[model samples]
Target chain A: AQSVTQPDIHITVSEGASLELRCNYSYGATPYLFWYVQSPGQGLQLLLKYFSGDTLVQGIKGFEAEFKRSQSSFNLRKPSVHWSDAAEYFCALTYLCYNNNDMRFGAGTRLTVKP
Target chain B: EAGVAQSPRYKIIEKRQSVAFWCNPISGHATLYWYQQILGQGPKLLIQFQNNGVVDDSQLPKDRFSAERLKGVDSTLKIQPAKLEDSAVYLCASSFGTDTQYFGPGTRLTVL
Candidate 1:
């Protein structure tokens, strides 16, 4: 079985400040990683993804994540956060199921950015 | 692109009652997903469909929950007898392939 762990349950940062959310996964082989954000009463939107190659992937809303093979981590970071950045963040890992299925998500982290 | 679409944005039902949710994936998307999101928890993959076929459904509670994706386009999820623990948001998502999954607004199910 595969699982993802988002260490930070909740995080707070002031507006315009930098922010980082930690994520780690337990997979047997190479894993495809992704980050998603959900605003209040809204659907989940993609932030970024890492399939392979250089490892550093940039996404919408000025978000970026770097996949580390050694660390089993794919942390999301934003140089500056806006008040609207307050939302729930999730990390995921993609792998095939018994009959070649795909993707699974983490527990999630609630982000609160103050003004 | 219209993105994924789900009906009945909110639903309220008593325990032992039955309810059904619908979803229509993007026009050409081949992969569709159903997720269960409990309060204070992340969305869990309940089922996945590749076109009109089932790809994965191990996590889905087969005892009271059933789903189907007919014609490889639209889908429906049915709960035979709702339980209090079944109260949660049912999210529908789709992907062009297996690359990225896009989610819909979700159906908030409240079972009392």
Candidate 2:
């Protein structure tokens, strides 16, 4: 079974500070990885995805994720954190098998921005 | 382009009652998905539809839960004799053939 693990349940960082959220996956083959952000009372929005090619992938809202095959990790990073960036972050994996896509998400990490 | 749309952002019902949720996916999206998201947990896929046909429903509880995607555009999920454990946010998402899925604002269901 393919699964994603977000080790951080909650993270607090000062405004303008750098941020990194750890994610690890258990899968035998290369998997499609994604990062999604969910704000309170709103639907989740896609931040970035890594299908293939370059390991470092850029996404919306000044977010980026690096997929490391060796570590089986796809960590999300941002150069500077903002108050608006405080939300629940989820790392997801999608496996394509027999023309069907099965997607799964991690438990999610809630980020808090401190002044 | 319009994003996915869902109705009745919130619903409150007593246990053993029944409830239904509606979803309208983006135009031209062939794949539709329904997910259940309990508080403090990630969303779990309950069912998947490919152009009005059931593609994957292994996770869906067939006894009291049912869903349909008619015309391959709009879809509905219903739960009968809702249990306390069924209280969760129901999310609907759609994607173009094997593409990234776009989600709609979920419908929060509370079983008293």
Candidate 3:
């Protein structure tokens, strides 16, 4: 079974500060990784995805994630944080089983921005 | 393009009551999904459909939950004899193939 782990329960950062959200996954085969953001009262939005190729993948809203196979990790990063960026972030793994695709999501990390 | 659409943004019912939620996927989307998201946790896949055919439903609790996408366009999820633990957001999503899925606003189900 494929599982995703986001160690951070909540994180607080001041505006303009750098931010990083940790994510780790456990899967037998090479995994398809993704980062999603959910604001209050809204559905989950795709931040980015990592299928193959580049280890570091850029996403919308100045977000990026690096897939590290050695560490079994895909950490989301941003150079500067904005107030609007405060939201719940989730890491998910897409598993392909016998031509069927299933997505498993992590517990998610709640981000809060301080001004 | 328009994203996935779901109806009844919020619903409240007492335990053991029955409720149903609806979803309309994007135009030409061949895949649709239903997920249950408990508060403070990530969404869990309840069922998946590919062009009006059942693909995966291993995690769905068949005893009280059922879903169908008849025309491969719109779908409905029904839950009977709901439990307190069933209080959560039911998310509907759709995709063109196996790529990124676009999600709906979600139907918040509350059991009293």
Candidate 4:
């Protein structure tokens, strides 16, 4: 079974500060990775997804993630975070195979922005 | 385009009571998914349906939980004799194909 782990349970940052959230996955074959953000009382929104192509992919709100195959990591990064960026983030992993595409998500990392 | 819709937005029940959550997927969507999300955890797939037929439900607690997508448009997830551990948000999502899932504002279930 493929699983994802997000080491940070909660992170605090000030407005306009740089942010980085670590994610690691365990999968046998090539992996399809994704990052999602969930605000209070809102549905999960897709932040970014990496299926195939370049290792670095950019997402909304100036968020970006790099798919590092050697380390089995797809850490999310933001140059500067806005107050609105304070939300729970999740990392998910799925097999790249066309036959079985069941995806598994990490526990989640909550981000809090302090003024 | 209208996103996936779910209701009631909030549900509260005591342990051992019965509760149900309803979901309406996007028009023309062929796949619907039901997920259970415990507090501070990611949503876990409870069931998946491809047009009115079950695709995957291996993670569902079949002994006490049941879900159905009749007519291939709307879905309902029911829990009989709800348990305290079942207190969590029930999320409903759908996709145009099998690639990306668009989620709805989940129904928060609180079991007393």
lDDT of 2 by residue, A39-82 (tens): 99888899999999999999999999999999999999999999
Residue pairs clashing in model 1 are A97-A101
Ranked candidates (DockQ, high to low): 2, 3, 1, 4
Residue pairs with clashing backbones, model 4: none
Docking outcome class, model 4: medium
Total clashing pairs in model 3:
0
Alpha-carbon TM-score of each model against the true structure = 0.97, 0.99, 0.98, 0.96
lDDT score for residue B9 of model 1? 94
DockQ pick, better of 2 and 3: 2
Off by over 4 Å in 1: A97-99
> Candidate 4: lDDT of B93?
88
* DockQ, model 4, C-alpha based: 0.63
Q: What is the iRMS for every candidate structure?
A: 1.8, 0.8, 0.9, 1.8
lDDT of 4 by residue, B1-112 (tens): 8999999999999999999999999899888989999998999989988889887888999999999988999999999989999999999988766777778999999999
lDDT of 4 at B37: 92
How many clashing residue pairs are found in candidate 2? 0
**Chain B: TM-scores of all predictions:** 0.98, 0.98, 0.98, 0.98
Docking class of 3: high
Top-TM-score candidate index: 2
In the range A1-115, model 4's lDDT, one tens digit per residue, is 6899999999999999999999999988778899999999878899999988999999988999999999999999999989999999999986634322466899999999999
